[model samples]
Target: MTDQGLGKDDKTPRTARGERTRRALLAAAAQEFGEKGFHEGSISGITRRAGCALGSFYTYFDTKDDIFRALVADMSGQVRDYVSPRIAEARDGIDAERIGLLSFLEFARSHKELYRIIDESEFVDAAAYRAHYENTAARVATRLAKAAERGEVRPDVEEVHAWAIMGMNVFLGLRYGIWDDSRPADEIAAIANALIEKGIGTRPD
Candidate 1:
């Protein structure tokens, strides 16, 4: 994960050491919640995992709920940070989607706890749960719009198309990334890219 602050609500660390401490706490929180879940997880577990004093946790977060909320946002940002640049290297809109899913599958395989933590947020923090997917779909919509402007995709692409593609990627990650790892990331991405190419790609013939 990036060495960045969790979110606006999180007490932004001032010093480099403080930033490191904050990142450690967030990483620890991911593990704590990822394995034991929100209810079973404790601040002590997080502090212990982080190898920091109890006071260090509170220096950045006020309560368990505060930290959990921050952690959700942090994880969401982590996905965006990991995937965006790779997508930028794509040859065009369709290839961008392929790269996006490929990177996401790779990220999910490594961060195996990501799906569990995000899934639990629906009950633990509904607002953050909604924001995660909504923001993701918005990014897809924006990408599709840009692609249409570039004549890479159908001119009629809209919000619903974005949601459909986002939904497909989410499930594909769950099945191929979390449930199994035998399949190559590019193989899965290629299959999905085919659908996008047929559904939306602009035709020259």
Candidate 2:
């Protein structure tokens, strides 16, 4: 009845428990969605898989669509977390490009579920998906710009080049990482790094 709603002690435990339940649900939802596309997935199925009640799903998400959106956001954040540090260490120019390419492949290998979700989402919801992809590319471009300024890559290279390199990684992930037979993640990363760096590396006059 008070502004605390259920009172202090009650509210605290409820909030903590709710958060834990919500995170579990989302984790399960991401796995389900990645395995089965959004259209084929259901709230009941997600809740069942998560071991939560039907009504509890609404406490965290109003609908399946809401859950999907949240999953995309979470997956994007995970990718950024995985790649940002490696990119940060690339203060040396060529190493920046090498790091960026390798980091992307490694991230995909580490989070294949999230990567599959992202890839499928792009075709079904191009606008929302592209916005997130472009934002990531922009961040990578900033790193590339710094490297270019330091003579790491060709000065004439544009941010689009960064986006292109990222695209190559995405397709490679689709073909080799996700679909093809197992190969070492490092070996795949090395192949991608070679392709991107060779194309982008500075050439002597």
Number of colliding residue pairs in each model: 0, 0
- Candidate that would win on TM-score: 1
Q: Report the C-alpha displacement of residue 42, candidate 1, in angstroms.
A: 0.5
lDDT of each: 0.93, 0.74
Off by over 4 Å in 2: 1-14, 200-205
Query: Tens digits of per-residue lDDT for model 2 on 28-58?
Result: 8987887788889889889998998987776
For candidate 2, which ten residues in a row score worst on lDDT?
A: 4-13
Choose the strongest candidate by lDDT: 1
lDDT of 1: 0.93
lDDT, candidate 1, 140-194, per-residue tens: 9999999999999999999999999999999999999999989999999999999
